[model samples]
Target: MNTIEHRLMELEAKVAFQDETIEILNDEIKVHQQQMAKIKRQTELLAEKLKESQSSQPMMSNMPEPPPPHY
Candidate 1:
């Protein structure tokens, strides 16, 4: 085969390999995104539960003052 044809073939092979690598990277990115979304949802749920638990407790600072007795 001629040198030009051989070089072209090698370049084509490299391009194909690069394309496959890009596809694999894309798939990994998608998986990471899904994991991040799941973690975000779990964090939100935990925060909501924490807020509810805190709200259910009574606050001593908000209690009404007792009336003073007459002498």
Candidate 2:
């Protein structure tokens, strides 16, 4: 092939390789986003449950400690 044609082919090959890599990276980003969303939702649910449990239980720090059984 002529020099110009060979250079063009080389450029095309590089572009094709870059396009494939970009596509792979984009797919991985989508998966990570989905996982992050799921984790966020789970964390929110756990926080809500913790809040509910705390609200339902009465604070009892004022209660006296019982004497040790050894005494």
Candidate 3:
């Protein structure tokens, strides 16, 4: 084949490879996005549960101090 034709073929091959790589990267990004969303939801739920648990307990500040052991 002529030099120009060979160069064109090589360029086409490189383009094809780049296209495939981009697609794979896109798919990975989508999966990561989904995972991040799930993690965020779980974190929110955990925070809510923690808040609820804290609210259910009695506050220590409200209780009066007891007499000293020396008394």
Candidate 4:
């Protein structure tokens, strides 16, 4: 075969390897995205629970008190 034909065959092999590597990377990215979504949901739930607790509790520091004689 000519030098050009040999070079073309080598380039084709390199391209095929790169394509396979890209496919594997894409699959890993998808898995990471799923994990991130689950974490986001859990974080939102925790925030809601925190809000509920804050609202349901009384502010003991703000209670009324009797006036002092100096008042």
lDDT of 3 at 62: 92
Model 4 C-alpha lDDT per residue in residues 7-44, reported as the tens digit of each score: 99999999999999999999999999999999999999
TM-score of 2: 0.87
Q: Residues 1-71, candidate 1, lDDT per residue (tens digit)?
A: 69999999999999999999999999999999999999999999999999998799887579886778862
Instruction: Report how far off residue 38 is in candidate 3 (Å).
Output: 0.5
Worst 10 residues of 1 by lDDT: 62-71
Error of 4 at 35 (Å): 0.6
What TM-score number comes out for model 4?
A: 0.78
Model 2, 1-71: lDDT tens digits are 69999999999999999999999999999999999999999999999999999888875666787989999
- The number of the candidate with the highest TM-score is 2
In model 1, residue pairs whose N, Cα or C atoms come closer than 3 Å (at least 3 residues apart or on different chains), thus clashing, are none
- Cα deviation of 25 in candidate 4 (Å)? 0.7
Better of 3 and 4 by TM-score: 3
Compared with the true structure, the alpha-carbon lDDT of candidate 3 equals: 0.97
- Superposition error at 33 for model 3 (Å): 0.6
Candidate 2 lDDT at 69 equals: 100
**Residue 6, model 2, lDDT:** 95
**What is the Cα root-mean-square deviation between model 4 and the actual structure?**
4.5
TM-score of each: 0.80, 0.87, 0.81, 0.78
RMSD values for the candidates in order, in angstroms, are: 6.2, 1.6, 2.6, 4.5
